[model samples]
Target: MFAGIEEVDWASMKHAYGPADDVPALLRGLASADPAERERALDGMYGAVHHQGDVYPCTLACIPFLFELVADPWVPDRGDIVELLTSIGGIDLGSDDEDEIDEDEAEGAANYAMAAAAVSAGAGVFFGLLADEDPGVRLSAPLALAALHDDPARVLALLRARLAAERDEEVRLALVEAAGRLALRHRPLAGPVADWFARLVGDPGPPGLRLAALAQLARCAPHALPGDVVPVVTGLLGQLRTSAAGPGSTRARPVEPPGQGAEAAPLTLRGQLRALSAEETAGRAAPWTADLLRTLHAGLDDRVAERVALLADQLRSPDPWQRVDAVRMSDRLIGGRRGSYAELVRLVGEQLAAPEPRLAESAAQLLAGLSGLAAPAADALAERVAADPADWVRTWPDGRTRLGSAATALARLGDPRVLPALTAALGHPLVPSELGPGVARLGEAALPLAGALRQRLSEAVLDERAYDRVGPVLVALAALRAGAAAPEVLRVLRGAPDAGGERLRTAALRALAAFGPAAGCAVPELRALVRRTGTVEAAEAAGALWAV
Candidate 1:
């Protein structure tokens, strides 16, 4: 299909990884009869030719060939080819005003402009593909048409018409999102598009469609957003959950019987496992539904209170996947914005007891990062920690056991109930770095574990790779005023290498200072460090010298 590919001077062009000589072979591989070879070729095209959204001279040359591949009905993964073209054309030029274009950026801007124009030239082909028989091709067409078409009027009109006739829920959602993006890019179309979104939101169509429209309306016209947006969204989400579980729902559809319809022959054990894995991956395969809600949450960016309320409703959803999505959104909101998230934090803490261990572990990890803000979840975290076996130290897939995460979260909130887990973790061969800090936070409450901490510190002083463990151990010893640890502290200070031991030396000095007069034997080493003048180690030594 790529008749003139060899006529081009590919050797003269440059891609991300040097030469563009491999571009032709990769293009030809896209038309391969075998799907695996086509996938490998597509990965190569993205990894090198248009690496990380960069459009090089080689990328521009490949555009015509890419278009040819998309137009060929027999080509596999035509949708992916369309997406790559959109990304290459979507470079942000910053400002059209010449005064804003500095000399250094001018050449790059010109290249971006050229790539965009080249992609825009294929708008007619994309428009025709909107009606392609392949649902995937149809789904991807609206985005390319909206993003690259030169005439915004025709693009918006065609998208509106497509939305009317589209029966696929996912495609209908894409058409709505594409129309919003087109209006946002072309300001003059905002008013009309906003009106359309408002009408769709009020329609008696699928709750999913209305939710998508509501989110888009918030984006295009924030002033037009209804006062009861939170309530409207909450109600719509409830309806969506109901519909998803009822008969005739796509999500509720059972897996096709072996050898049925479009699916290939009877399944083997491995095939059935793969099918189940795909269904359970990331909670659900239909992310667009969750994505629409996320967009609406982002559109109400300034209204933190409203966002928090919506999250509370979502966290309480009967749909486990929606709860998982809410936990992530709660994390983002708590981390980025200043708001009253006590209710949100409490809701997230409730997930610590979720039936699914993965969800419960995720909730614990989130709570651990919240610091003092996680106080509302302290009881729940404490309960989780207490429920674990005294020797619970099994490793999870991500290297953190459930007991470790829960205990860490509980200890961060100053609960002493985590003492057992922290103490048990201390004796484990592979001690968690968090154990030291968790013990340190408890002050005298952790005094009972001082002997264990000192023993770990002595053992850690001999291992060079145990710096992560040593620093926190020293801090915990200093916090507890463990007088017996002074010898180990002095040994670390004296034996630590001059080059990479700056932090270790500083922590030792601080620990000795906390020991007060009990650290008199460290005087000689402290004086030597003090003479290293004008450095941080010298300052820390001087402080310890005065304290001793």
Candidate 2:
């Protein structure tokens, strides 16, 4: 259909592709057995012509011709059409009158000029195609509009208008894409642009679409997401927290209620803005730092450690919005130099016993930073960590990557109190990450106890207690030697009963295989364990058997 000037009767073809006249060609392309022929006809008509007025009736003619192809059932690609319109509209296609025109011709020329001027004039014709009955045409239209619509205000207006009237999910999504592009351009638009986004952020149409809209809003105005939108992000944070809590099955509820204003709004517009501002200032000191500090210190006294303790307990709240703000404030209060390190340590120490795993993890990280500044808090933090239950230390409830940050923090503090918990946690499924750092901290302080831990495993081969207790000890022992426990490692493997002993004993043997000749004495038993557990574990052992 779009055969360029040489392939068609340019004068007659002008109206042939117009909406009122298009029929036979569109029907032929739609019914073609060869999909490529249909695709070629569509792409050629939509993509081949660039300078619409250079060889035909003024740019005014492109309005109908382009719309015809745009409305065609076989016009599967909007991007191609967008490129076509963008190329022709971006250049001077020349005036409608060829020479000095009569007064009557001047009106025709003025009508063409009005239709051709403004980026929107070209886009208006394309946007009109969005109203076509065909879904393909509807989907393609906004994309062309997004590509060609240069007037940000008009584009935003068209989007809101379409959004209110649009019933098709696919077209609604196209509107989302259009809005995102406009937002990205950062152009001044109709007042409703922000409101439209705020509405979507508050009640995202679908999960994927909601997240995409939230991310775009965050990118555009990290600190100024409308107050109504905060609940959506806070809701996601709650989902993550609940999943972290434990594996018990509680029936899930709809993420948001069907009606508007159904949940307590998490933050006011000001609070949402401040949170984003703090995030933006993560690496730099914010101007609001002094103000933030004064506000936090308003009712509390510096001399009162109990007041600090109460503040730390707030970290354990079930309300995710509060929890998030609490963590951010803690990072500011404790990490900011305006506060004493002693205060920070005191605050974190109090929070460790708090029931919430997410809060406890935060306290652990804060304590880790404080360890280098004050040694007294180190032992205190270690004691509390060591006293915690083994399972509690095993995995974090939130989607956190590490559960025993407190143990790691304690290790960094050079306190031996954390050794028991660290050693106990070593064989658990998620224990490997905390192992290296903890052992490195244990250093020379752990040598005397290392032998005892090794002997416990050696003495208790037939006992379940030993099976449960020894794997972490083995990991700790190997780590302390800087990979020197091969001989002792081999002896344990030879002695432990496969039926009564646990998977940790086998894992211990494999750990030795990693050090090779550094672990040469354990080579034979490791090979046997490999035969038992198969090549994967055996291979790790095999590599360690010879030092390479």
Candidate 3:
């Protein structure tokens, strides 16, 4: 081996940097007489194999050497080396080290190895360290184990022991973090974790830890936490949940001078919950029901409004258990003096005008529920519905609350004011045609407004910005029974420029499909559109041609 090795060219050794032979050479150089030579050899070889971008060989060769370098006390600033250790296969801290290791090295190695193992679940070799002599290592091990490997039994046993025997504050806290992470993923761990969580519920370690425990309890198994614990978490989360509502999470009502009509008590959880039940049983007819919700609704100041909204959101939740509180809050807001039918319509209007669509949808649902029974309020909502501008709709976008929900809300409201808005929306590029039923549902209320709408569509059809408007317009046209606008539709399909005309052609076909034989001349245009774009527009046009 020495005969050929001494003569080999070192400068041109990049080709020989493959893991198989290079790993041994680099390993032997770890304790070379010249530190520069040792450092250079390891750095060059590690860099080449890792960056070479081949997954298998790089992982196999680098794991042990990286661990050795990480353990080497002589090497300072080991973050980069540790990160390298994690990037390939994770480091194995569980491996029997024949040499005795210091506490700091063990902790550092445990943390670094855990981070690496998180990427590869098969890094079970690190699991045995759950019982490491160092508390930090013990605490950190569970987190690593939870991520890289999954065995609820082992995790449960370690956590149980830590909960029982762990006396150090920091270690106890780490155990809580581990428990939350474990319980959050595997619900079965909730029993033991909840025991630990219950101990710290109000004891107060750190704000972050408490919040984490609360979040874990809320997310994993709310019932596992004690009933007393639930309210504390609810109160804290309620404060956080409602921090945006008004001024402060809790508000003080003025003390009455002996007789202010039973001086209204500040809404408490128990009372609000009771009212929520009454509201559900009584529905719109129950006299006491609406008042229950109103009490909570009245709590909405800038400080408490977020809580109010959160409560309302909960009332509206699809989950029956959550609905009681949400209903109680909503009833109080909508039916009680604080939230009454009159107030609800106004609130809905405010949400409609709000920049956020989610708020607008909430307002819309409130309006929909109140429709007819709250006829005067619905009438008022109608006017605002018409004035609100349109927004783009996408099934999947980067953000959750987009403008489409507001449009849907308006449609769901079915108030007449929506007609002019819908007609005006014809030019909106993002509105989808699927909204026709919603617009049409508004019925003859929309009929009287059709003439004015036709003029807007005609004007919009000619504008350059009207490209995206074309499809939605046609969809709305079908919605409005604006069949007479067929000629205008045909003209746009035939003559509009390519820049905006593509949508026009597509909308033209869709409109013609909606128009049927009444649009006989549109047959040629429909065929043209289908050939130009392979969309439903083409298929609808072909169907329309046959229907004609």
Candidate 4:
């Protein structure tokens, strides 16, 4: 079946690395006995061939081989190969949603469809995998079918049938979602598909499953939904509170098992590929309601304001799980649209001062993500950061994360009054995650704080946390063209973690390079870095020296 692999002019084809000569070896590596080697080969293939999902022409060239690989049960990570084929074949295009929506064509939808044609042309394998003995393979089959530009509806019946036969909860969840996306894109199937989802919502084994169905139902057929939206949401929230609080997995790194949210083992390949982001993946080890919470928020199209209000109420719920879900909803509701919610911002902003440490921290983080849309709550966020307990400096659980969250929110608000607080935060030995980015957002406008930033660079401690403090400040200072920072940055880079770790070294070198010839004083240390290590840091150091 792979005879064609050698027949092609492989040398001439371009992958991410400019030539496809290495493609055949990587493909063979998929079946390697060594898991580590196979993992490396897979990573290499994705990086060089798909290259952050920019499918090259050579990507299409490998389609037939992938189809063959997916059909062979002997191939390890066969589900991953199927998913790879699906991603290569599928385009992220706008739904066939006829509703007046202000949405764009899925980013690179055209390129995606064009790349996916190679796999769709071999649609027979995908359709066959829907009933494969391995549940992992079966899960990916429907997703692959969803990529079908031409016979999308052809897989609808197959998915529904599999959903009934499928005993594994994760596989069933993917099938239902695939069905929803297909129904949305292939408008003709909406009525029947919507009815299927509606049926699942009321008659359910688990509340998460039902909530997932309702979310999809609302999305694919908003007008077809029943009148009692709020009550259904209320029940789902109750179920979530129960789920999240139930004895979560005790493992250091937990992977949720199929059908059960209470505990997790190590994740399967199928588990990692789903829509939820990596950050959301960890919570799964806990009895996670995050997926449903995210889906419900994402699915609400009609009565959106009412749903948002309901979500806000739940954010203030006494149950920790309900509150966690609500906090997540606040971030999701904004969805980058300034016009979407006035009340959401107000409520979440107020939550920034909530007595519960978790709620206040989550609220601050959410506000930072909302940017200028969260401007109205800037005053409250600023006050919270200002009122950070004096004892927080040494014993804070996350060092400066909580304080930084509030300061970051103020920076995003683009309010000038945020400068004093931000400058103080930046000068602290433990800077918060993304606080430097918030500072960078202020750009050259932060030039006024250049003197203090330089002083902080010189005086800051070089503890493990020092990297976070100095790295972002270095980047921000460079962005602000604070050439005066070169000397202090040079000192930190030559020093150890006790002076600031590799993070500061890397950032300082990059900052020096940003200064061009203005960083002349650091030439000796930069040359030594190139000579001693010759790693990525070496390259950065060499570049800095050249610029100097």
Candidate 5:
């Protein structure tokens, strides 16, 4: 179908990388009979060519070939190809309006402007895909055309008409979201579209359609929505608040930050901000209720206090999902400045003692993160640490990702009660996270756990499997400036090379040498290690010698 695939001067055009020469090779790999090969090709192409919606010239040129591939009947995983086109065309939905972006985001605003301009140039390809025969292709069309076109009457009529005949619930959801996104771009038609969404929302039809319409209203034309919108959304959230996962469920509640997941590529700081939206939660396979709650909160921006009140209600909900949604919402509302809204902080503080274990766990994690915010909840966290240990489900690890653990939270709250809990957790066989960092976050407050941390440090010397925990443990000791533990640090420095790998040895050296000249005893070993070490360990070893 691609007539000149080989003849295209892809080398002249730039993609995410410096040259677009690799683009054709990856695209050809997409046609491989092996499923794994095709998946890898798609992933590599996505990361390099259309990373975080930054559309390079090579990306634009590849659009027609993608369309041809999607239309090919014998193509393996046609659905995925169609989805890729939809993602590519999503650059079309990007807005160039500078006012919508933060003033500090000169780069973000500029990136969006470039992507939108480039994608909008190829508007005709998306508009024509509206009547594609495949169900997946048909569903993707409206979203692709959304912000790419400004003709309110034309796009709305097309989407609204498509929705009437659309039988698939998933496709119907996409259509409504697309219509809302389009309305956001074109304000002239927002009032009518808002009226349409409000009607769809209140209709006693399929719950999914109603929920989709509600989410769309939250995105665009929120002002034009009906007066009874709140009740309609509230009722939907109640329906979706079932405490347990549904049938055909793995029951795994993945806590990911939008598209900032580990899958596509490592995101730059600005890419993270640009990817934030209701789409992450709303379109997920489960937790539709959380999605609605987040969307409702997004549309109710007219009053911050009111938004907090709504979230506070969820925080107190008996249903675990509602409470989880509340935690997620609070993270968005009162970020670092927990003092800005003392009332919100106080109300949130109450959740640290919530009867529901998950709610209390997430709340503890939230307060632990904010400097001094946890102080208001110190007493409550103390109560948590005093209680018998419960089985807590860990969503993710602590570093490079936002993870939650009651033990981690208590450790960071700086309450003396955390000392005993940290001691017990260190002995537990299945502890959620390394207790050391949370102890380190407590800084000098962690002195009580010094003995336990040392015990674990000694265990690391005996157990090879315990070596990974060595770094965080050393960090805690260094933070305490526990000169008394210098002997243990020296042991790790001596044993790490023979017992553990390069990483363990480096961490041990860092811990022993982090303090001042009190560590002079280790100076000889530090100098010898510096000579044999790779770049990273050499840096650590040099610092250790300087400390001595």
Candidate 6:
């Protein structure tokens, strides 16, 4: 298939790893009889040839051979090859803002354009692959066509045709996503595509398709999104949960078996260790359908209210995986965005009482970050803490303790009921770093725990790697106005360079400031810090100096 590959002076070209001498061997490996060899080859192609989406001369040269592999039915990983081609062709040209391209970026831009054009020239292959018997190939083709095809109208037509005949749910979703991408890339086609997506959303087909269409519609033509999008999405999520729970249903099925798919990529010793570590650290795996719904929710982007509303329903879902997924989504949305997320917070709080300890722990963790916004969940969080104060010390499968998370949430909401749990956590060998902030939030109500905080701070100051633990303790001390900690706070400020980064230094300085003139011993150090201009530390030090 790679007939003229040898004629090319591969040694003369450069990929991410210098010489492109390995290009041909890698290409050959793509068609190897062994799946491992093929996976290794694809890894090399992406790792070196098109590293981090930067197209190289070797990357452009490998395009034709990649296409040949895609066209060949015998190629076991043709779908993955199609995806690689899409990545090569999908480089953001920054066409919308040509004026922003500087000289340093010009060569990369040119290479990207060349790579994209090369792939687009082979768009005919993808169109044929759209009908390929392999569902993987069929799934990856529409996106390639949408991304690389020069004729938007033809790409749209073929995608619609495929969508009509596509019975595979994954491929059908891909078709809808491709149509959205096509409309977004080619704005002239947006009106019609929005209409088509709207129709899909209203269709009586699987709720997943409708959800996909609704998400895309929110993206490409947000103005076209129906007023009832939240309710519609909520109902669709209910349907999805029902279908996923039904006997013989394939909705929540994993995309690939364990030890396969993207995780199956060849890895270096370090990469393998890191992957194993991540797997061990990650608790229970969520259902595959939860991931799909998360993607759809992400597409809603800045539509906070709608996203929150959808999360409420998801949190209420009977499916544990769906609820778990909702807890994660709530953490991101509520923590990052600004809005009245009371209802969402309340729903998340409801999960704190869930029978599943893991789900309750997840919900508690989410609430812990919300502070005042977590008020609605206060009663539930307090209940968990009161139920078993020792739960704070009891570790979960994910390495988090229940009452620890719940107590943190309660303390953040300014509930003094968590004082016992908070104090108990301080005496534990593995003190929760969050203990400091939660204690700080309670102000004088947390003064009883000041002795424990000071003891932990003393221990933390001795360990250089305990900088994260120290900073919060310093903040808590400052909030409590603990005059007794002024010496330790001064020690931290004086040894800031060895102790930690600017965070610890700032925290120490702020603590000294809270002690007012009682921390007069730190005046000279504070003055020196103030003179180190144009830094956050200097500003914080100046504030401390003024307070002193």
Best by TM-score: 1
TM-score of 6: 0.80
Give residue 387's lDDT in candidate 4 (0 to 100): 81
- Sliding window of 10 residues with minimal summed lDDT for model 2: 249-258
Q: Put the candidates in lDDT order, highest first.
A: 1, 6, 4, 5, 2, 3
Q: Each prediction's TM-score against the native?
A: 0.89, 0.35, 0.46, 0.62, 0.62, 0.80
Comparison by TM-score, 3 against 4, better one: 4
lDDT of candidate 2 over 1-548, digit per residue (tens): 54342333344544224432232353245334454444444433432222233322433444445545544555544334444554444443254445778886665456444444543454766666666665545655675676556666776777778877776554565676667657655445423455566567667354324444454454444444544433454454344345433212111111111121323323333234434654443432112222222332332334234324434444444543344345555565555434444654554565666665655666666766654653545655766676775533655464222436677677777677766765565435334445545665777777755655555555544444444445555666665663555556666666666556656565565557454456655656655655745545466555555553
Q: Write the per-residue lDDT of candidate 3 for residues 158-245, one digit (tens) a residue.
A: 6657556655444444555566667766777777777766666665444334545554554455565444533453454434333343
User: How do the residues 322-436 of candidate 1 rate in per-residue lDDT, one tens digit apiece?
Assistant: 7888888888888888999888999999998889776787788899898789999999888888787542455656544334667777778778888888777766555666765
> Candidate 4 residues 171-279, lDDT tens each?
6777888888898778889999998888988795566567668778877887766688777877776675566443243221222333334223223342444323434
Candidate 6, overall lDDT?
0.79
- Pick the winner on lDDT between candidates 2 and 6: 6
Q: Please give the distance, in angstroms, between residue 67's alpha carbon in candidate 2 and its true position after superposition.
A: 19
What CA root-mean-square deviation does each model show from the true structure? 4.8, 18.2, 17.5, 11.7, 9.3, 5.3
Clashing pairs in model 1, backbone N/Cα/C closer than 3 A: none
- lDDT for position 62 in model 6: 90
The TM-score obtained by model 1 is: 0.89
Candidate 1 worst ten-residue window by lDDT? 246-255
CA lDDT of each prediction against the hidden true structure: 0.79, 0.51, 0.49, 0.70, 0.64, 0.79
Ranking by TM-score: 1, 6, 4, 5, 3, 2
Residue-by-residue lDDT tens digits, candidate 6, 145-180: 988899999999989988888887778888988998
List runs of model 1 lying over 4 Å from the truth.
95-105, 244-286, 389-403, 497-500, 531-536
Q: After superposition, how far is residue 90 of candidate 5 from its true place, in Å?
A: 5.3
